[model samples]
Target chain A: MYKGIAASRGIGIGSICRIIEHDLTFEARQITDTAAEKQRFREAVEAFVQETTAMAADIRKRIGPKEAEILEGHIVMIMDPSMSGEMEKMIDAGQCAETALTAVCDMFYGMFSSMNDDMMRQRASDIADVKVSVLKKLLGIEDVDISKVAPGTVLVCRDLTPSMTSQIVGGNVAGIITEIGGKTSHSAILARALEIPAVLSVPGIVDAVKDKDTAVIDGTEGEVYINPEGDILARFVLKREEFIRKQAELNSFIGKETLTADGQKVELFCNIGTPKDARKALECDGEGIGLFRSEFLFMDNTRLPSEDEQYEAYREAAQIMGGKTVIIRTLDIGGDKDIPYLKMQKEDNPFLGYRAVRYCLGNPDIYKTQLKAILRASAHGHVKIMIPLVTTVDEVRGVKSLVEELKKELDAEGKAYDKNIQVGCMIETASASLIADLLAKEADFFSIGTNDLTQYTMSVDRGNPNVAYLYSAFQPAVLRSIKNIIECANKAHIPVGMCGEAAADPLMIPLLMAFGLDEYSVNPVLVLTARCIISKWTRAEACELSDRILAMDTEAEIVAALKIAAKE
Target chain B: MVSKKMTIKNEQGMHMRPASLLSQKATAFTCSVKINYSGNSYDCKSIMFLMAACIKCGSDIELVCDGPDEEKALNDISEFIESGMGD
Candidate 1:
């Protein structure tokens, strides 16, 4: 059993089809006829451009413009006289066209691959992609057309680019197994978007399984069983069938109110990073957006987004929700999110260092620009500003004052905005949870960012693989902090919600429900699953179970109890 | 010859898109354009050479242009760099 990240939800049992990336190799023979070689190189370039242009159009038509833009870049690279000119000059220097092209491309690729920036490093792959396509044209080799893949085939490859993933979709691919890629890698995201079961980051998986080998992939459990024994195969086949049935059943819960068995309604919201994700939230029947991470706007670009750029993004999200609450978090940079333009000092422990609300509060110009933009977007639809990593009442007060100042500025400028726009704070840090009552008085609502809360409370770096085993949301200390915050919010008479991976976990659902969490914000893909889980349980029983589980001393005890309770 | 200093404004620096754009513009001119950064000069008409230079964000590079249409090439390339290659 190969354990990897379960990127998508579902079970897929299919014959494995390994995709060995074609590495082009050629002999370097001296060319006496420079003119003919140059002409040949030009012909190859022309063919490459024509092919990429057609592919771009097809991708645009099949997928969308954003993905097609990758192919469009290749077209520009092929047409760039600098690249082709270098190749032509080499041809004129008594070198074969293939040798020249390879040398020039390798030079460019080497530079790109050595870059410190992730985006720039990805450009190296882009250059390599163009090189392969051009080489194929020159060698008369057919491109790997994943679109023509046989249905129900599990695609096994080293890795997949967004362009390759787009082709794999609608090609009847049952599952995807990649040897490299994290949960947030392009292939994983594409797998989730395509709703195909995916197991990623399984080292040497391509070599372990041969072509036409029957494989069973459990995306939810992050396990891949290759050519399993008779009993295991039979069990997996049954599991796959049951999973399909459960998926169909979950679809029935769509459009249905997220209510407990006793008719206690709980708001089901979605967490989104980009404005484009708002559509996915809507499709999942999310009641609102609990956390619209604003950092993506800052992190994806070279510089901070202007007020207008931020406004358009926020407005698009607000307009899409159509009065449904959209909780737009302020720019939560620093920590794991390093924006180079910010020029933040490298810290020994970044997670506990100057990050989130601290960074925004320090940079007033950056903070106000985003504040003004979110407030401007409020005029379009329902928009609330939520501050992240707040550990003090003073921080909440500070942000409120900034919002007040921005509101007055907007009013003076004759710009209309939601005068009653609500403000909230994330109860993620231990200090924030402890002082929840003080914050609840100033803030309109509270959303527990459990990921950080767990990290901070346990004093564990969740990203550290060494200590990752101790990073559990069900840990007694983390649960105690959550319980304390919920109780504090209840005392203050403000609704409390959770916007973290914990909220989406089926095992944690009952505990959070029992704690009387008014809202549950999760990834859009988990909305229906969460709803179904909520619909099946009574709030009172969940509360009772939560109370019992909270009394447990260890995570193992809580897990055992949860399993028993879940079975009951 | 006309030389002007410009800072790379795009977050990604002189990446493929910006390199291609600059190279395309430079080739359109009869002038020879050289970009000098960190004490090294690269042919501005070669995208491969420009990309290999790895001019990151906030780097100040000098654009030197000579021959007929030198002024036009320098002005256009300067404007493109300043615009952050339409980031």
Candidate 2:
């Protein structure tokens, strides 16, 4: 078994078909007829453009327009005057077309590779790709037609390029193994977009595998088996079937409302960090935006984002959500997230020090800018303000007062806004959980941030490896706190949502349902899976399991019980 | 030469798409379009040069256009950059 980067999730069993790179070796000689050489270079470029354009069209239809853009970029890159023109200049000086192409590509490749930005650095690889394709054209070499590969063929290559990936027929390729490339590389992105199981950056994979060799790919685990034992292959076959069956089940849950077996409906939402991610939440069939971390606008900028900038960001998300709830968590920074511009003094224990709501309330100018922006955005859709790290009732009240002040200011300025926009508290601290009823009465809603709740409740620094074992939302103490927070919210007739990793855990879903969680907000990709899990348990069954879990004394015993009762 | 200084407002500055668009638009003009970033001059008509400049969001750069249509070129390119390069 070989370990590699798991680029895409799924299991695939197939016969290997190694994609050997073509040799484009050529003899360089001085040419007296520079005109003819320049013509040769231009023709080769034209041919490259024609072929790439066709492939872009095919990929656009087969995969997506976004993936097609990678191919379409090649045409634009090669046609750039700095590219083709430079090559022609070198060719006009009596250099061979191959030499000219290599020289110009190398220059741009060096320019892009030296950049500090990751996205700009990827352009260096794009230059290399263009060089190879144009070189192949000049050398009169044929590419391996990936579209014609036999069904169930697992492709082994050094690295998958966008042009080569464009020819892939998803049904024909069962899996892909590459010698180099990471999860975010073009190879991985294309493989995932095609929905083909892929294991990338496997060392010596191309040279080790032969055509027709049987292989089993556990893409989820990033493990590959070459000509495995009969029993191992049989086990993998069953695993593959189970994965496919599970995926189909999850896909069927899309476009459906979140409901329990006994017909209790709940909100299924997604946690997003940026405005653009709202589109992904919609794509994943999320009912609303549960937690929109508003720190990206500040973290990604050198200076503090202006009020107009923050408003545009919030309005963009609200517009994309189309009236769905967008709970914007105002700047939860100064903990592990240190922005240089903020100039927050270094603290001995940052997480326990001035952070989140405490920092915001102290810095009224910054806090008011964000609050007013959010209030202005509320006019576009269902926008809510969620205060983070609220340990005291005054923190929630302070934020509410600020919102009220901002609303009055907006009214005086004759600015249109949502007057009834909800202000909520993110119950993450032990103090907040203990005084949940007070917070529930003061705040409009509650969203449990289980990560920090578990940490503060158990006095375990999740970052400390030695204490990591103690940091789990399933811990009896943490579970009880979650239960109390939910009960407090319910008793006050306010909606309570959970926007933490535990909210989507299949084992934890039933307990949350039993606790009467009004909303579950998880990663966008987990929406269907969470909805599917929620549909499996009736309230009575969940309550019985929760009762048993709540009666357990230790985390280990409760986890064991929950695991046994978990529905797959 | 006509020139104007502007900050790149696009979330991702001078990436493939923006570079391509800027270069294509610049190529249509009968002028020498160049971007002066961090004391370095980059040909705006070349996507390769524009991308290699690595001008990120919030980077203040000068757009210079020299030739018969320098005024028109500078105005158009400055407008495009100010509009976040159609991002």
> In model 2, which runs have C-alpha deviations exceeding 4 angstroms?
none
- Residues B28-48, model 1: lDDT tens digits: 899899999999999988776
| TM-score of model number 1 | 0.72
TM-score of chain B of each: 0.95, 0.97
The prediction achieving the highest DockQ against the true structure is 2
The interface RMSD values of the models, given in order, are 4.4, 1.1
Worst 10 residues of 1 chain B by lDDT: B6-15
Q: Write the per-residue lDDT of candidate 1 for residues A1-568, one digit (tens) a residue.
A: 8998888878888888888877678889899999998888888889988867787787688766656777788777666666787788889999998898888888888887897766666677778777877887788888578888888899898887665776775647888888877676657766876779999888999888899998889998889989889999899889888988898989899899999989989999999998878998998789999999988778766677889878978998999999899999998888888999889999998988999899889989999999999999999999999999999988999999999999999999999999999999999999998888788899999999999999998899877799998999999988888888888888888889999999988899998888778999999989998999888799779988987998889999999999888821
CAPRI docking class of candidate 2: medium
Shares of reference contacts reproduced by the candidates, in order, are 0.44, 0.81
Model 1 residue A189 distance off true place after TM-score fit, in angstroms: 6.1
Report lDDT per candidate.
0.86, 0.92
User: Worst 10-residue stretch by lDDT in candidate 2 chain A?
Assistant: A115-124
* Candidate 1 local lDDT, residue A415: 99
lDDT score for residue A51 of model 1: 69
| Segments of candidate 1 deviating more than 4 angstroms | A1-12, A15-36, A116-121, A142-227, A242-266, A270-289, A292-382, A387-402, A409-417, A428-441, A451-495, A523-532, A538-559, B1-87
